[model samples]
Target: MQRRNFLRAAAIGAGVTAFGNTLTRTAMAAPAQNGPGPYGPLQPANANGIQLPAGFTSRVVARSGQQVAGYTWHNAPDGGAVFADGGGWIYVSNSEINPGGGVSALRFDADATITGAYRILANTRLNCAGGAMPWNKWLSCEEIDLGFVYETDPWGAAAVQRPAMGRFKHEAAAADPVRRAIYLTEDVPDGCLYRFLPTTWGDLSSGTLQVIRAGTATSGSFTWGTVPDPDGSPTATRNQVSGAKRFNGGEGLHYANDTAWFTTKGDNRVWQLNLAASTYELAYDDSLVSPGTAPLTGVDNVTGSSSGDLYVAEDGGNMEICVITPNDIVAPFLRVTGQSGSEITGPAFTPAGNRLYFSSQRGTSGSSSGGITYEVTGPFRS
Candidate 1:
């Protein structure tokens, strides 16, 4: 079945409740393993100075500041997710600039090289990060104070800004095929996590926007809280004040196994929201926080692998790709060094999971010395 039709069906089934339901039973079943090279981990190199594991290799897929079909020059590209069309085509999201910039629709060949690039949305601001819809469309979100969610077609033609999802500082988004709802993150102080119930699941034209309350879904109030001490230490109760949840910049959201995984850049932590129970919990503790110990590296953008592994794009300190396995082992899967002030973003795996694509942005020195999309070909052992 087509992804869009599937999502619409799931959304109708999910609306049985107002808050939204977890993915259906069949959708939650274990993912199937198909077509690949080997089961071992390997890394390689590319034109860009990115270093990967033993068997993996890297290449420059696309670069920023380059002139595409509609724009004069490409600005900062952020939060990319992969959409594998049935015809061996890949559509990537280039979160466009703020103050009126649109998302970039990039088409890639089977080898993962850029075939075409064009603008989808225009005259927007802070097009931070977004996820791929099951129907093969891209949902680009604005991260500004009065941001709105925009839906773009795979060819960069059809574009619509959805206001029902709430007008706030938006961040990353993830679509749950089972529930037919899209999970959203707000990149603001005291921002709340939200889920939008589309009046018609696959059709994002209209929906009901609701925030995730801590205690239960029955409560209509949108409450907030900080990451308390896991060991039960005496800490002050932080209220859900306007912009009180400092640094909880809700970024990098993805859904897998009936749960939602997201990153908190401000507090330097990753969390998992169990939709089944309407509860939130930490997926990776402070120990594995970005810029933390070995394995699990720090990151600014993150996505899920085909095998259920979590790939984090390290945006701070060390420029590397970190992978979180189902067993919770955090480790550096790839590293990008030698480039002046270069940081990695948008770590997404192809549908086959054989190739991993990512982008590097201008380093802290304000130089575009190393802005490129890298392809890591290897057996990503989950």
Candidate 2:
């Protein structure tokens, strides 16, 4: 544990102090109907200006334009994922800057020491949220109207463009090997959900891109229709297929347990799609929150844990990362203070589930260059 202690003390110096480790779970301070979430109510904001549950502590991992280990971190850090190496792990983050958007990575050893920092994808525009593939590839997405997905390697390999995934303002992607498909979300106000079925399970060279076909209901039966052109030149992908269901400002996505969960920022709702029954329903809607005003809004990048706890990060609403448990309870697990102008991005858990990594796309100064990445460690439910 000396290494971890060193990480708190000397890893990033004043920017990485840890706190709020000595409190008991007596009572909570959230909605009453569904009770408190897994970690109980959050304590006062710590040195990093974050309010976490008792026994949980946070540290600054990287900051925009600041040296992380040696290399300067990228601005507007967004959509990140962790990949396990032999002994260490790599966390790759995408830059949301318009002209020079790309992907930057932070490498950490087994003891959490910053071994190195580098860029994986370069010269790309508006690189936003992405997903970590089962085969160790990072599917970095773009938020532009005609952006493409870049399959970048976590171990410093060259990046490849995956245009076969379709084009039209992509937000996030989640692969489901059980169904042999990768689900995608669009960022437009009335964007349609999509799926790319590769010719081979592990390869992404060629695939049949399809869109979800359903009624306008939040929960219902659905089907997929193939898109004639993944390129979306003369006709955009969303308008190519008839009856394609529209989501209000689709954002992040994740696949697990034969279900694909995605978020829509415009409506502040997390949607659940059951692959087995072809059914879709709302997992969390701020308007439907019970017994109090919904504690979550500005819903953005979402990631889940082994315990079925879905940690949903906010884009602006109080800058909190709310947890939606399997039992349908939603509560604020942690909140970042003085970040009202910034949004929470890339809420990902490590392979061992011991720590959570994310970033405030714009820090307290309310500028892209002020972005800050953080890691929170505690007794996360396993």
Candidate 3:
């Protein structure tokens, strides 16, 4: 299709939007329950190898081993968060290396150009995925035994590790701003979902770590049990508890719309936990759906759209970004083509919701040594 004609056909209910295509009835519309919105079948990517819906375009902001300013762009850029800085924003990315892995902070201009990049936390192990706090801090998780989550300033500051939050291959965390609670996910096959209730809100130095025990399918009333060892030692933390509920592989977690949305890689399931009602329910389970029906599998890092929908990234195969609508319908939002075998991680949107930032943990060659951070811009619901 010609560029002009393609743009014309892409326009649906909305006026000419900058990015994101409006879903037409023929373009993989959401389940009947989910009303129309600004998402549909992906258009051929104009960029090197990424396909986004019409109006949406992406640019490679940072690539592994690329030197920008003083620091070399970190390899294996895992989970990250975007924070509003002076005029533009600072994107903090994690390095998933074994011995010298840590967090790197990049300063971008208002136009999203890299101004400077530097290492904030160094000498950590397998810094995988983490979340941002309500108080303007990024929690970088170390996916290792007895690994601690480091709270670092996104604008280049020293990091303080919070061991009280529990260990055992931590993946990501979500903060409940209203209740001052932090929800965490473990990355092991028998990982347990944890919640830390700090003595004082926003203070992570001291807290009571507990695990969830669900009574219903995915939603409903749930109970909690204390974790005897927040730090793994003689016995693994998950194994220490007698009946601590286990998620196959708790990979990514995000808190939005008064609920906590998370994914389990082992089972390819996305779950929703109502913070107010204290219940958990399965929102999307790929195993329950026939093969080739769902675009999402190996669900990894996740973020929230302005419309209260959840954007989930695939870790291994497929390499697609899937959206879970408010009514629980899951569909394709974007797919990474040319980047062979690399999984998507760290899907975060700016506060304005106009731009979405994420990283390809393994670069185009699918090697751990290469990775790239990218941003997609268009009309994202706010």
- lDDT score for candidate 3 against the true structure: 0.75
Per-residue lDDT for 90 in model 3?
79
4: Cα error in model 3, Å: 40
Q: Alpha carbon lDDT of residue 170, candidate 3?
A: 92
**What is residue 328's positional error in candidate 1, in angstroms?**
1.3
Ranking of all candidate structures by their TM-score, best first: 2, 3, 1
Clash totals for all candidate models: 23, 0, 7
* TM-score pick, better of 1 and 3: 3
lDDT of each: 0.59, 0.81, 0.75
Point out where model 3 deviates above 4 Å.
Answer: 1-37, 215-219, 290-292
> Which residue runs does candidate 2 get wrong by more than 4 Å?
1-34
Candidate 3: tens digits of C-alpha lDDT, residues 1-382: 1000000112111211111122111112212122233477788866558988878889888888988777788889999877777668777889998998899987878887778899999999999999887677888999988888999888776889898998778999877756778889999888889888988987889989988876434445677888887787878888876667778889888765346768899988877766666756666778665344656788999876546566889987678888766554667788888876798987876655688888888878788777988889997654
Q: How large is the C-alpha RMSD of every model relative to the true structure?
A: 9.2, 8.6, 8.0
lDDT, model 2, position 66: 92
TM-score of every candidate relative to the true structure: 0.76, 0.91, 0.87
Clashes of 3: 7
Reference-based lDDT, residue 16, model 3: 13
TM-score of 3: 0.87
The better candidate by lDDT, 1 or 3, is: 3
